[model samples]
Target: MIDTAASLSRFKRKTPRRVIWKRQGLAFLFLAPGLILFLLMIWYPTVQTVLFSFQNVGLTGSKGWVGLNNFDRMFGDPQFIIAWRNSIVFVLLSLIMGLAVPIVLALMINEMRRFASVFQLIVYLPALIPSAVGLLIWRLIYQPEQTGILNSMLKLVGLPPQLWLSDPNLAKPLIIVIMTWLSAGGSTLIYLSALREIPVEFLEAAELDGFSPFQRVWYVVLPLISSRIQIMLVLQIIIVAQVFTEPFILTQGGPASATMTPVLEIYNAAFVNSDFGLASAWSVSMLVVLSIFSVIYVWLRREDTGMN
Candidate 1:
């Protein structure tokens, strides 16, 4: 009897260990495919990019290892400076338009007691359009000639037609406008969702305390949605810093490299100039900038989780 009792206790303890091991095995089994895909798709390319940055790769293959020669060439290039400056300007413009406009739209949409879905659909419609198609449409609209859609509108308003994408000064800002028009809807939806999550009681309490609509929004609503604002700000900065497609399709870094951006520079180096090594170095530099923002994103996420 004593032996049986001791054996039963041992069995009970062993069963839980076996169950835990089984669960762990199953968890790993479920995670294996995703982990393998991540390694192949993300990690492998990242490693290759870093390695290629140090080598003089061409159409044939790598000429040989060139140490930091690719990086030296990239930094010394005048276009590189122009691209970096343009990227910074794009980021600032995106912050002004992309960040504030969405919040305002979201707030206005949130107050609608009717036709809210219609409003949402209208706002988000542009986002549903293919990026290439949208850029093409905007390209035509930004044509320098008087027959261009925007220029035609200016004519109707008795205003002078202006060169948009063709003008070095206007090209970058026009791109930003197109970007905001294309992107603001999704951001507006996100902000609206965040705004909805704010407890009704908080707003009611603020109202009872004699808060005006503006005061309530400024004091109560903004604070609650501030985290989302931070997240969107960082994301916009990262994205605008890598502005490529719009400039590629619209300006092609032309009109004195006014709308040139880092990613565009990278693309030009690799495909246009057939200098893969220099392209990879430029990519690595961009990666460093993006990684800093990525770290901030992760830290902000953790802080938000802790606060919750």
Candidate 2:
């Protein structure tokens, strides 16, 4: 009887231990699919990109190992420099001027007591428009002739028919404007969500303290939503830096490569020039730059929070 009791106790303890191990095993099994997909899609490509950056690769074959020559070549190319400058300008414009509009618009929408859904729908409509269709519509409007929609409107106002996308001086800024218009709605939607998450008690307290509507928003709402705004700013910077389709379809990096961006340069290097190795090198550089930008944005945002 003593032996039976001891054996039963041991079995009970062992059973629970086995069950815990089984549960942990099942959890990892469930997670494996997602982990595998992430590694295959994200990690593998990154490793491949870094490797290809070093080799003297083309569409044909590996000519030889070119250590830093591809990067050196990039530095010497004036067009690459131009593209890099334009990319920086694009990132700055999108973050500062482009990002602010959405935040302001979202706040305005939140203040409305009626027709809120209508306002949201209208604000989001621009983002829903297909990119190709949007680009085509803007292309026609940006046409250099008086027959163009914008030039005709300018003529009505007694202003000169401007070469919106043709002139080197105006093309990049014009592209930036188009990007801002199309993308503002997405940012507004994000800010709207963040604004909604703010505690109503906070606003009420501000109101009772003799704070005006503007003051409440400026002091209370803005600070609370700052984190979301920072996240969106980083995302916008990354997207704008890699801007391709709009410029490729609309400008083709034309009028002396004025609106050319890094991604455009990468495409030209790989496909047009058939220098896949050099293209990969440029892509690697872009990745490094993007990673740095992301880190800085995160650090600055953390500092903002720490200050508050």
Candidate 3:
């Protein structure tokens, strides 16, 4: 009887160890593909970019080590300065237009008692469409010709057709508008999801305290959703700073380079200009600048995770 009891205890211990080993093996099997892709697609390129930024990488291959010269050139270039200025402007405009639209829409949508799903579908439709198609649609609407939609409206008012994308002053703002329209839908859904998670009693409590509707939103709702807003603000800055598609498809950084951005400049340096060395330098510079915002975003999310 004693021997049998000892055998049973040993079997129990060994069974749990085998089960744990099997679970770990399964976990690693599921993780292996993602790890391989990350190393190949993301990590490898990043390492190459860092290495190439310091060296003189020609079209064929690396020429030699030329430390700090690329950085100096990037700083000295006139177009690069314009690119940075434009990137800053993009961030500012996105904060004003891109960031607020979603929050406002989410707030309005949250108050709905009926047909909310219909409104959500309508709002999110723009995002569901391909970004290229959305930009192209705007391109047609903003066409500088008299036959174009906006120009046709102007013609009806006995006004001359204005150069929309070709006007240096108008180019950046117009592109920003397109970006806002395209992005607002997706962002609204995010904020709406956050709004839905708020407890009902909180709003009721605010009303009982005799807070007005505006006060309820401003004080109660905004405070509750501030975490989402904070994280989105950083993300918006990061996205706008590296804006490529809007300018690339619509203006191609034209209208006297009014819509020129850092990413666009990097692209032009690599392919259009055939100067891979300069392109790598530009990429590194953008990485450094944008990494500040990235770190802020990560830290904010980490705080959120910890709170949860």
Give the TM-score comparing model 2 with the true structure, all chains together: 0.87
Worst 10 residues of 1 by lDDT: 299-308
What TM-score fits each model?
A: 0.91, 0.87, 0.89
| Per-residue lDDT of 18 in model 2 | 99
The global C-alpha lDDT for each of the candidates, from Candidate 1 onward, is 0.91, 0.87, 0.90
Ranking by lDDT: 1, 3, 2
Candidate 3 wrongly placed segments (more than 4 Å): 1-27, 303-308
RMSD of 2: 3.5
Model 2 lDDT at residue 41: 99
On TM-score, the leading prediction is: 1
Off by over 4 Å in 2: 1-25, 60-64, 296-308
Root-mean-square deviation of each candidate, in angstroms?
2.5, 3.5, 3.0
lDDT of 1 by residue, 167-243 (tens): 88888888889999999999999999999999999999999999999999999999999989999899888888988
Q: Which of 1 and 2 is ahead in lDDT?
A: 1
